[model samples]
Target: MPSYYDIDAILTDSQKVPCTFEITVPGLGYLDGNPGEPIKEGTKVELPLWLGEMLAVTQNNTNTPTLSLDLPQCLSARVVNALKADPRVVDIRALAPHFYALGSRMLELFDEEELLDVLTDTFKRRAKEIADQAHHPRGVLGEGAEFLRGLDESERQLFRSAHESSKAVRNWMVDLKK
Candidate 1:
């Protein structure tokens, strides 16, 4: 099954702005001697956004950090490009649920409505192409088909219609051969 979440995107966006962290161990001299007070074990300190994320990941048991981010609008464009490049290799729908959840939690996280609309439009267009091509005997459903399957209820309905149309065409061809 295809995953329906973009955890890396969420993590990246979440760590966009610098935030505070509670350190649990010592010996992180690299992050010390900066503008702010030196980071020490057992003390709370503020760190740069990227640094904080790195430290939190590297020193999981040693730091507890908070993050907030404003997801960039370009993300959707990137996704669209990836889908266009190889809809069979890219599952754009995988990001829908995560986008929805994150957008709900953080209104400013992303242009949720716009992203959803764009994704739906792109998926529909690509799915139609796939369906049309599917009538060929050798056509193979790939990641694009999986992406369509992962769509939300309404979007899935659209894919289902296209798929049904393709099926009908295939049956008609078989009847003609008979």
Candidate 2:
């Protein structure tokens, strides 16, 4: 399960989900299910709002959830490190399932404001399941790029672009003072 914030988006055409997300990773964006879908970088793309929230929530939280627009460098790294240090995760490193089986019961709730509550509850349950698996059965990505690699292509590309941009912003911080 992933955590989510209270971000809002209006529904667009059925073709485009209510939320749009632009992906900008050179080779990361591949519309595996939607054939011939153009992969655009440095541009805006609309995806289902639920998808965007998933990306957003996972990026923001370690175990507890917090919403901050700016990437929390130390915080994100701390969670990743904690997960990595966990004995359960380290021992299961060898199975390397390549992907965790997300419960089909999992569904993204968005496009309507009311769904947020439903989403909130769903996210908590899912997060608990994930944390459990982290501590016991099944392996995890250890809360970083390593964990992110476990994502499917579409989601992975989205994260890559966000991460790449965040890195650029972080690198420019020192120069910004000048």
Candidate 3:
């Protein structure tokens, strides 16, 4: 089965925002930013979210990293602009999971309803276009149809209405053929 979620994009985006956490165990290796020096126990340090999550999971003793709200707004704006410019050219399927995760985190951290609303609207519009393309394959959407088939329930919900409309169109076409 094709994978719908873009793991690479998620990992890349996660690394963009650094977070601070304290090491509770000794001799874990160098912190991402503070290289060459081994991260000693009880040493507070800043690390990218991707590395932080890794260390936290592996060590099982580090403090939970506090996410910094430094990039979500800018990232959201960029995503919105890119989708607005050309929904067809841009790979919404590739970025949808990352954008959704970041937007959810931003909402929790800052409660910025307006930004989240804009992001959500932009994503829905892009998803609608992608769904339309799914009915009539072209360009990336040709391959994207397979990717769309692999979307998780939550992600699929974004294009649910569009998918339903497309289904109706397909059924009508079938009837006409008969």
Find the candidate with the highest TM-score and give its number. Answer: 3
lDDT of model 2, residue 99: 13
User: Order of candidates by lDDT, top first?
Assistant: 3, 1, 2
> Residue 23 in candidate 3 has what lDDT?
43
TM-score of each: 0.32, 0.23, 0.46
lDDT of 3 at 167: 82
User: Each prediction's Cα RMSD?
Assistant: 10.4, 19.4, 7.7
- Tens digits of per-residue lDDT, candidate 1, 33-95, equal 543444554444444334554554453543444322334332446765765565444543455
lDDT of 3 by residue, 1-178 (tens): 1244766445434544534344433344455345555555455554555555455445343344322224433355676666566544554445534555655554554667666766677656656655666556555456566656544335566556666787898999999999
Clashing pairs in 2: 1-126, 1-127, 20-46, 21-45, 141-147
Candidate 2 regions off by >4 Å? 1-146
Worst lDDT window (10 residues) for model 3?
Answer: 65-74
Worst 10 residues of 2 by lDDT: 6-15
Candidate 3 stretches with Cα past 4 Å from truth are 1-16, 20-29, 32-69, 72-97, 139-178
Q: Where does candidate 1 clash, by residue pair?
A: none
Winner on TM-score between 2 and 3 is 3
Superposed model 1: Cα runs more than 4 Å off = 1-65, 69-77, 80-111, 137-178
